[model samples]
Every structure is written in structure tokens, then in C-alpha cells.
Target: MKPLQTWVPVPENSDFTIYNLPFGIFSVAGDAPRAGIAIGDQIIDLAVLADAGLIAPEKDYFTQPTLNRFIGLGKKVTNEVRLQVQRLLIDEDSELKKNPRFLVPQSEATMHLPIKIGDYTDFYSSLEHATNVGKMFRDPENALLPNWKHIPVGYHGRASSVVVSGTPIHRPKGQVMPKGAASPVFKPTGRLDFELEMAFVVGRNSDLGESVPVSRAEEYIFGMVLFNDWSARDIQKWEYVPLGPFLGKSFASSMSPWIVTMEALEPFRVKGPDQDPEVLPYLRTEGPKNYDIDLSVGIRPQNGEEEVLCRSNFKYMYWNMAQQLAHHTINGCNICVGDVMASGTISGKDETSYGSMLELSWGGQKTIDLKNGATRTFIEDNDTITMRGSAKKGDVSIGFGEVSGKILPAK
Candidate 1:
């Protein structure tokens, strides 16, 4: 397939390509937030296009702060809208090309959370990440747990704290058992970290007592977004015994505004790592379950230069999204549209490919050298963390812009 040239001028290496029309909510000035598609440096306002009788369905689904309603309309309608935008972009005589009002500059528009999440689930699916963590705290020889290869381990997380990119997160104060302390002390986290991840939005609702098969899991997914699952190492280290993450992780999580649809990612699909001993029937999946997305993390201190921390790929996942969704629903758990399921910290084989600061610094034993003559084992105040992802094939590229957040003093 050849890359389609658009009349809309796209700068070199811009994430928003003509072939990738990611959806998000955007507003300029005092106007209400509405659905729009990202193309180059401009946002194609869906509301304006619908009102102009150009590429609308029976009714306008773009008049909302959240894309839940529009996404709930199913992929048939959503994919058609994307196709319509693609057609209009390439055809020079189209009304979209004539009227530039609908194309809002991304600089002027404010990007918002694409969906109102009802539920959130974070999965520990990366073999390298799990093994690295196990080696740090548990046994190095038996790094992987007994059931690690069998199921997609996950836990429910706080949906209320999930914010869009540029949102600031304050250091969460919680109980921590300091080194050699008899008891725990309540204070701000000494070791705050960011987990590089990707999350898929649920596009359809499932009925109670119904299980979606692994083969058909993609049918219920709408799109993907770059996710940053912020963590407090000390807070989690003490509390993640009987139950999983609480205040340590619930305080804040950030997501990229634009959602790169599964349709757009179809070209970048590849087979995931082989599962030894084979998965259960419910978790079995066919070819090319994982996407070959390049992921990177960068951190910048206040008034300092940014430093790239780690570079990993989504293809390194031991468990894929289909297995996660299928395993989640195997017990008859129903999923709703806008429910986010995050792929836990994606780590690779190399030392530089480690996802979290805990792994990168070997649990605070070593310091990470920064660009501005600074060193860090964990995040500091005013330190900004950004995560970006992109998938590229022969002639096509799809980007999940970025999820960024700056840390603030503990409140």
C-alpha cells in the first residue's frame, strides 16, 4: 500500500499522518469540547463537519465532552467516519479542503481526555518487566512466578484519577517502612516512578455472565493510547502484599489525548512472544496478536534538559491484549465502553529497556545520570515525565502522540 498524499500540508515526521486520523476531544478558547480527528498539526472538527452535511451520519455524535456516546455507536459507525475523513483529506475538491474553519490548529485547541472512563484495569503482562521486578525483590533464578505464563495478571485501579496529558500530579503521601525501621512512617513517597504502558479503550459493552472469546477480543476494542501508570515505589512496596496498588497508583495516571484506532493499527500487527506450556483454551489466540509499536520514556527536571530513559517495544509483551481481555472476561466479567485496560510496564531484554525507575536504578541502589548534571533514583519535584509511542511499517506510520505529567510538591 502507498502513502496517500494530502492537500493538507504535513510537516516531515509529524505524528499525525494522513493515514492516521486519531480521534480526541478538543476545544478552542471558551467553546465546549467536541470530538475531532487529528491530521498533521490541525484538528478536523467533527461537529462542524456534521453540521455542514459533509460526513455525518443520521445524527451528530461529536457534540459531547466525552467520546463514550460516539464510541458506543460501535465500530461500524466510527470506522466509517474515519474513512470519510481519509477520503475528504485526499480529494482536493472536497468541501473539507475548501472550508478551513473546521480544521482547527492544534496549537490553539486544548486537548482533553478522549473518554470518561468507568473502570480501569492494569495488567502485568511484560515478561521482562515481571522478571526484572522478581529478580530485584524475589528470586533471580525463579524470576517468573508459577502462574506468570498461564494468565494475564491484573488488578482493578482507580478510574477517577486518570487524567489527560499535561495534567500535574502531586507527590502522594503514604505510610512507608523505612530501612531498618521497626514500624512504618507516614510521609511523601521517596521513590516515585512512571510505568511506560499502552491502554486499549473498550468500544462495546458486554452483557453480564457473558465471556468474550480470545479470537473475538479485538471486536470490542476501539483504539489504543499511550498510558503512564504513575507509581510510588515505597508506598506500593508496603501495601502490595494481600491486595494490589491503592493510593500509590490511584493518585494519578496520565493518557495521550488522541486515540489511534485498532483499524489504523491493523497494518502494524505482529505475533507476540510464544507462550510456553500453552495457555488455557480461553486464553488461546491466533497470529499477530501484538502491535509492533516503538515506545520511549523521557524525564526533564525543572528548567533542565530532557533525558531519554528507556526505549522498548510493545511487541516484547509476553501476554497480549486479547489474552488480557479474554482472561478478564473468562469469569463472566462484563466490560463497558470507555473502560480502560492498561498494559503494565513494558520492559525489554536490555538494561536500558527497563520501564520503571525502580528497575532502571535497581531499586534505588544506583543513580540515573541526567542531561543537566543531575542524578535521580526516583522522580523529584517539578520533574516532568513524558511517554510516546509510534508504529511504522514500510510506507505507513501511526502515532499515539504522548502522555506527559509534571510532579508537584506533596499536598
Candidate 2:
């Protein structure tokens, strides 16, 4: 679809165009979470449209802290709502074109979490990230573990601790093993780090005894968001000997406030990395299932400026979204609306494509030179890690604004 000619200053082009009806909750006058759709530079308040009887049925699901209630209404209802809102916002034939007073300028509204997360699971599905990380601690033959290729590897994460973007993350305190030590020492995390990931929000619930097939997996996913699963590497290495990450990962996670629906991203969708040994039957997919979103990580020291640290793409993932969601329900585990399934650190072949400091510096054995004669291996206490994403075609760029957090001293 060609771009529409709207008076809102979306430039001659913008990502939040008429075609993209991304959803979010906002408050214009100190109200609770009310549905809104991004159109150019304006926000179409869904709750108000519903109340005015301008939009149909899903109106009752508005005015909540999260989008779970609205999302629970099913994808059929979701598609209809999205299409109707799209027409109302862009089509001149609709009543929205006649009444512009009810429209809230995007600049004045506040964005909240689009969904209420009940469960979160982070998956290790990046091939290069796995290879690079493995090469650091083991021989090339031993890089990928025996079970790495066969299944989707993941760990349950702390959900309550997840925060929206713009939050300040305190340096977490944990046990770190000092050099040549038979025992470990406890202290504030010294090696804070960032992971560039893409997270999907669950749209519907599935029963405990039923598995969501790969074919119908997209139906369960409402949308995608750029996610930063903050980490404390020093603490993680010491504590993850037996079980997986706890304090090292539980401290903080940041996500972009806007939930870009699957429909909007469909144009950029493509096939994922090929599975060599062939995925397990439960993890099989029959179509092109990944989106071509260019993602990156940028770091700015407290005293210094911003430098694009790494660049990568979501298409580098070895396991696609469908495979991840399918494997998640293999045990007949029930998944509810608002549950988050995240793609782990996305990295590519080049040094600039490395997603984490562990990969960039090869486990702190080398130093990364900065623009102003500074260098770093892991994040400093006051350093800020910002992650940005976009999918550009020709002159227009479909963007995921950014997810950023400053590292504060441990509390």
C-alpha cells in the first residue's frame, strides 16, 4: 500500500504509517491504560472510538492496565478490530475523518505496557551467539552442546521484575569468583551486560494438555517487541554451574512500549536459517516464518557519548518464532495471554554484529576501543546500554523506537 497523505507531520514517510496499526495503552489525562493506535504523529484512542460507537464490539475490553483482556478476545476479533481501526483512522469515508478533536497528539500521550505478563521464558536460539560463546570456553568441536541442535533451549525468568523502557536498572548484587579462588565472594555485580532480543506477546491461552502446532503458532502471538534481557555475566558464570541464571538475569529487563502487530510486519517476513539435522517433529515449520528486522546495540558511558556497539538482524535466529512456541508447549504446558516468549541474544558473523560484551571482547580477554580513546569489556556502573531496531526498504524505515536503560550503582 502506498503511503497516505495525512496532515500529521509523519514526514513524507514514517514507520507508524496508515498501514501499521500498532497497539499500545496510553493516558492523556491521568487515566488508566486505554487502547490507542499509532497513525502518523497522532494516536487514535480506541477506547474513545468504542465509547462513541464509531468502532465495533471489542470496545468493552479497553481501560485496563494491560492488553491481555483485549487480546484474549481471539485473533479473529483482533484482525477485525485492527482492520476497522485502520479504516477509521485512514479512510476518508469513515467518521474519524470528520472529527479530529477526539484525536490525541502522539506527543502528549503516555505509553504503558501493552500486555500484562504472567510468564516469561528466554530462549538461546542464535547460532553465532552460541558458537562465539562456546568458542570462548571450549574447543570448536565442543562449542555447541550435544542437545543444542535438537531442541529449543530456554529458562524461566522473573516476570515481576520486567520493566518498560526508560527504567533505571540498579547494578545487582551477587556472588563472583575472584581469580584463583576455591570459594566465591559476594558483592554488587561488576560485569553488567545487555542482550539484544526480540520478544513475542501471547494473544490467546492454550490448555495444559494440548500442544500448539507450528502451523497455527502465529495465531497465538499477538505482536513483537525489541527486548533487552539485562545480564550480570560475572555473577552468571559463578551461579549457573548447576542451575541456570537467577540473580544475574532477574535484576532487570527492558522492552519497547509499542507492540507491533504481526500484520504490519508481514511484508518483511522471510524464511529463517536452515535446520541441518532437521528439527524434531514438534519443531517443524512449513513456511517462511521470520521477519527481516535490523537490530543493534549501542552503549554510552556515563561520561562519554553514544557509539553503536553492535549490529545484527532477527533473521539470524536458528529457531524461528513458531519453533520456539511449538517446543514450549511440547510438554502440554499451558500458556496464557500476556506470556512473553523471547528470542535470545541475536548475533552475526562479524565483530560489530556481536550482541554481548562476552562476544565482542571474547570474554574480556581483549578490549574494545572507543571513539575517544576509551575501551570496555563489560558495562560499567553508570554506562547506559541502548538497543534499537528497524526494517528499511527503499526510503521508508519501519522502526522500533528504542529500549534503553542506565546502569546505576547497586542498592
Candidate 3:
């Protein structure tokens, strides 16, 4: 496909374009969270368009809060609306394009939580990341724990605490067991970190006892976004002896403002990781349909210094999105629209490609030298972290903008 021309005046240097019609929730001032689409530097209000009879849902879906109503319509309408919006915004013959009143400047728009997530599940799907993390705690003989390669390892995450991009995350207070301590003590997290990952938003619900196959998994996916699952290493190390992470992970998770539709990313799908042993029947797919997207993380200190930490790729993941989704509903689990599932800590084989601060610092042994001469092993209070992703195919690039969060001191 050739490059698309848009009247929105986005320069060649710009990442946001008509090709990437990302969706989100935003209100003018004090209204409830409603669906909106990003175009150029403006947000096209979906609620307004729906009210005008421009886009109406077949189901009584528009009544719900967030984008779940429209999202429950599934990929059929999602693609339809995306196509309609693209035609209206880019095609000169479109009625909405000719009308200047329909456009809203992005600077004035107040972005909010795009969807009301019912549940959050994060998976350790990246092969290199898992190996790196395992290498830190485990000795040379037992790097990867058994059962890791057999199934996609995951844990239920706190949904209520997940925040929109730019939200402030206060450092969490939890019990930590120091060396030679029989009991744990309560204190704020000292070794805070950011997990660089990508997550997908569920578009359709699967009824209990009904499983979604890998073949039809894409229909249930609405879009992709950046996800930062904050971690407190000290708390996790002490508490996660037998059970998985609890308070250290539940404190906060940050996601991007705009969600890039899967349709927009269709052209960029590459071959996914090859499974050594045969996967389960439900998790098996015909071919690799994963995208070779470039991912990078940046950190900014409270003192006003910024440094690029790591550069990795989504292709490093051992499991694909389809497999993850298929496995999620395999056991009669109900999955609702707008439920978020993240691919945990995407890292590459090289040292420079570490995704989380824990991996970058090598379990707090070495110092991560910054450009400004400052070094860090874990996140400091007031530090801002951003994760971004993009897939470039010659001239055109598919972007999932970025997700960012600022760490604040505990109350």
C-alpha cells in the first residue's frame, strides 16, 4: 500500500496520522468518560457523532460508560467505524471533512480512562525477559523454573488501581523481610521499577464455559496500547516466596492515552516465536501473525534529567497474543469487553535491551549510568517513566504512541 494523503497537515516527521486512528475516552470538562478517536492532533468526539446519528450501534451499547458499549460491537463495527472515520476525516468528498466545526483541537481535550477494565491479567510471555529475570535469583543450574515453558505464566492483577497515562503513582507501603529476618517490617517501597510491556484491549465478551479459539481471537481484540506494571523489587522478593506478587504489583499500572486498532497494525504482522514442543490444542495457530514492533523506555529523574534506558522488540515474546487470549478463556473463565491483558516485561537477549530497571541494574549490583552523570539502580520518587512502540515498514509506520507515569512519595 502506498502512503495515504491527509488534509490534517501532519508533517512527515509526525507519528500521529490518518492511518493510525487510535481511540480513547475524553470529555470537554466535567462530563462522564466517553469514546473519542485521535486524528492528527485532534480528538473526534464519538458521543457527539453518535448523538448526531452519524454512528449508531445496533445494540443498546452506547448507554454504558467508557468504550465497552461500542467495543462489545466487536471487530466488525470497530473496523467499520474506523473506515468511516478515516473516509470522513481524510477524503475531501466527506461531509464531516468539509465541516470545520466537527474537529476539536487535541491540546484542549481532556483525556481520561478509555475503558472500564473489569479485570487485569499480565503474562510472562517474553522468552528473553523471563530468562534474564530468572538468572538474577536462581543459580546457573536452575535459571528457568520448571512449568514456565509448558504454559503461559500469568497472575491476576489489580484492576481498580490501573491508571490512565500521566497519572501520578504514589510509592506503595508494604512489608519487607530483610536478610536473616524471621518477620517482615512495614515501609514504603525503596526499589521501585517499571516493566516495559504491550497490552491488548478486549473487544468482545466470552460467555462462561465457552472458549475462544486462536483462530477467532483477533475478532475479540479491539486494539493495542503501552502498559507499565510498576514493581517494588524489595517487597516482591520478600513476600513472593511461595505466592506471586500481590501489593507490590497492585499499587499502580499505567497505560497509554490512545489505543491503536488491530486493523491499522494488520500490515505489520510478522512471524511469532516458534514453539519447541507442541502447544495445547486451543493455543495452536496456523502461522505467526505477531508484529515486529520496536519498543523503548525512557526515564526522567525528579531533578529534571532524562535518559534512554533500554531498546527492545515485541518479537522477543515466546507466546503470541492469540495464544494468550485462547489460554485465558480455556477454563470457562468469563472475559468481558475492555478487559486488559499485558505481555509482561519485554526484553531482548543483550544487556542493553533490558526492559525493567531490575534487569538493567542486574539485581542492584551495577549502576545504570545516565547521560547527565547521575546513576540509578531503582526508581526514585518523582521519576517519570515512558514506554513507546512503533512498527516501521519502509515509509509508513504504525505507532502505539506511548504510556507514561510519574512516581510520587508515599502519603
Candidate 4:
């Protein structure tokens, strides 16, 4: 199919094309945040469109600060709304082309967290990333734990600290055991890291005792976003022996403002890596469950040029989103509309494609030489980390914009 042509002039390089109408929350001046769709370099204000009687919902879902309420209306309503907006963009004689109030320049709009995430889960799904970390920390021969091939390993994460892109995160102070030391010392994290990832937003709610089947897992998903799961390696290393991460990861996680819908990414679906051991019946899924998205990570030193740290892809995951969601609710754990589930550290087979400093620096044994003449084993204060992702197949392209966070000195 040809890319949807619109009267609205789209820059060739812009991520928002007529075919990719990602949604978000944005505000201008002192106005309250409202739902909007990204197209080219402009944000089509859904609230304005709703007010103009272009696309109406039963409730004022478009005027809300988060997309959760609008999404809770179900995919049938939300998808129709997106299709209506798409039609308006392509129709040359439509009122949208003549109206200036319905559109806002993206530069002027303050993007907010698209969803009010009620709960967050970070999954260790990437095969290469899991293997690399296991080799580094665990025995080389026995990298994967026993249950890795059977289930999608994940930990419930702190949702309150999750922030939108451009939020600054302070280095976390926590206990770390020094080399040749008997006890751990509390200090600002010396080995700060960033995990390049993609996360899906849950759209539908489930009952407390009902389990969502693997085949129907996609029904619960709304869209995807670039997620940067910030980490303090030292703190995690010391505390993650019996239990998982706490202060190290709970400090902050950043998310892209725009949410590229699952429907938009349908064209880019591809087969995921084959599981060695067959998954349980509840976790079994068919079809191309994974998406072929290009992902990259970059770091910009304070007052320096941004250098690409690594290049990876989402298809490297050992477990797909369907399996993750299936396993998550298999035990009858209910999920809410704004719940977030992240694919942790999407690393590839090569060292250049490693997702975190822990892998690229070989557990701080080597320093990553930067283009700005600075070297890094771990993130330093004032250094900014940015993650970008996109899916393309011929003329159709979908983008997740970017999630960026600058590290600040610990208070």
C-alpha cells in the first residue's frame, strides 16, 4: 500500500507521517494538558478536534491529561478515532486543512507522560543481553538460569518515579561494596548505567482471577514507547543477591512522550528468536510475535557532541511481548489500562550492540572512548543518555520519537 498522502506538508525526515499517527499528551502556555496526535512536525490537538465536532467521544476523553481514560474506552473506539483523524488529514477539502487552531507546532507544546502508569514491570527478555550479563557475572558455561527458557523473567518496578522524556535524574546514593572490603559503604552511584528498552502500555483491564490467554495477549496492549531503565550498577550488584533492584532502579525511568500504536506497527512484525525449550501451554504463541525495529543509544557529554554508544534491535528478544503479558497474567495478576511492561536491555550479539555500560565496558574493565575525547566506564554527572527507535518496511515507517534524561549530581 502507498503511504497516505496529506495536504499537511510533512518534512521528509519527520518521524510523524500520515501513516504513523502516534498519540500523546501535550500543553501549550498554561493550558491544562490534553490528548493529541503527532503528525509531521505538528500536533493535531484532539481536544480542539473534539470541540469542533470533528471526532466526538461519549466523554471528554480528549481533554484529559493522560491517554489512559481515552484508551480505556477500548480499541474499537480509540482506533476509530485514529482512523477519523487519518481521514481528516488526507481529505483536501476537510475543515482540518483550513483551521489553524486544531494544529499546534510540536516545538511549542510541552509533552507529558502519555499515560498515568499505575504499575510498571521490567522484563529480562533479550537473549543476548541476558547471556552477556550472565557471562560477566555468573559462570560462563552456565549463563542462563534454569527457568529462563521457560518463562519471561521480570520484576515489578516502581511506577511513581517514571518520568517523561527530558526529565533530569539525580544519581542515586546507595550502599556499594568496594573491592577487598568487608562491608558496603553508602555513596552516590559510581557506576550509573542506562538500559535501552521498549515498553508497551496496557490498554484493557483484567479481573483479579482471570488469566489472559497468550493468543489474546495483544488485545490488552495499546502501544509502544522508548523506555530508558536507568540503573546504578554498584547499588544493584550489592543488593540484588536475594532480592532484585530497589533504590538503584527505582530512582527514575524515562519514557518517550509519543506512543506508536500496535496497529501502526503491524507492518513491521517479524518472527522472534526460537525458544530452545518449548514454552508452557499457557505461554505458547504463534505468528511473528516480535517487531523488527531499529534501536540505538547515544550519550552526550556535558557541552560536547552526542556520540552513538550502541546499535541494537528489538527482534533480539528471547521472549516476545505476547509471552511476557501471558506469563504476567498467568497467575491471575490483574493489569490496568496504564500499566507498563518494558523489554529490558535490548542488546545484540556484538559488543558494539551492547545496551549498557556494564556490557560495553566489560564490567568497568575497559573504558568506552567517546568522540569528545572523554572516556567512560559508567555514566558521569551531567552526561545525557538518549534512546531512539523506529520500525520501517518499504514506505511505511513508525517512530517512537526518543526518551532522554540527563544525569545530575546526587543531592
For model 2 the local lDDT of residue 143 reads 94
Q: Tell me how many residue pairs clash in candidate 4.
A: 0
For residues 94-144, what per-residue lDDT tens digits would candidate 3 score against the true structure?
Answer: 666666656677787777778899999999998888888787888655777
Give TM per candidate: 0.99, 0.95, 0.95, 0.99
* Order of quality (lDDT): 1, 4, 2, 3
Off by over 4 Å in 2: 1-7, 394-397
| Clash totals in order | 0, 0, 0, 0
Which residue runs does candidate 3 get wrong by more than 4 Å? 58-65
lDDT of each: 0.93, 0.85, 0.84, 0.93
What does candidate 1's lDDT look like per residue over 1-411, in tens digits? 566889998888888998799999999998999999999999999999998988866445898999999999999999999999999999999999999898999999999999999999999999999999999889999998898988899999999999999999999999999999999999999999999999999999999899999999999999999999999999999998878789789999999999999999999999888889898888888888999999999999999988899999999999999899999998999999999999999999998999999999999999999878899999999999999999888879878888999999999
Model 2 Cα lDDT, one tens digit per residue, 145-185: 88899998999999988888878999999899987999999
For lDDT, candidate 3 versus 4, the one ahead is 4
Which lDDT tens digits does candidate 4 get at residues 33-148?
99999999999999889988899684389888899999998999888999999999999999999999999999999999999999999999988988888899998999988888
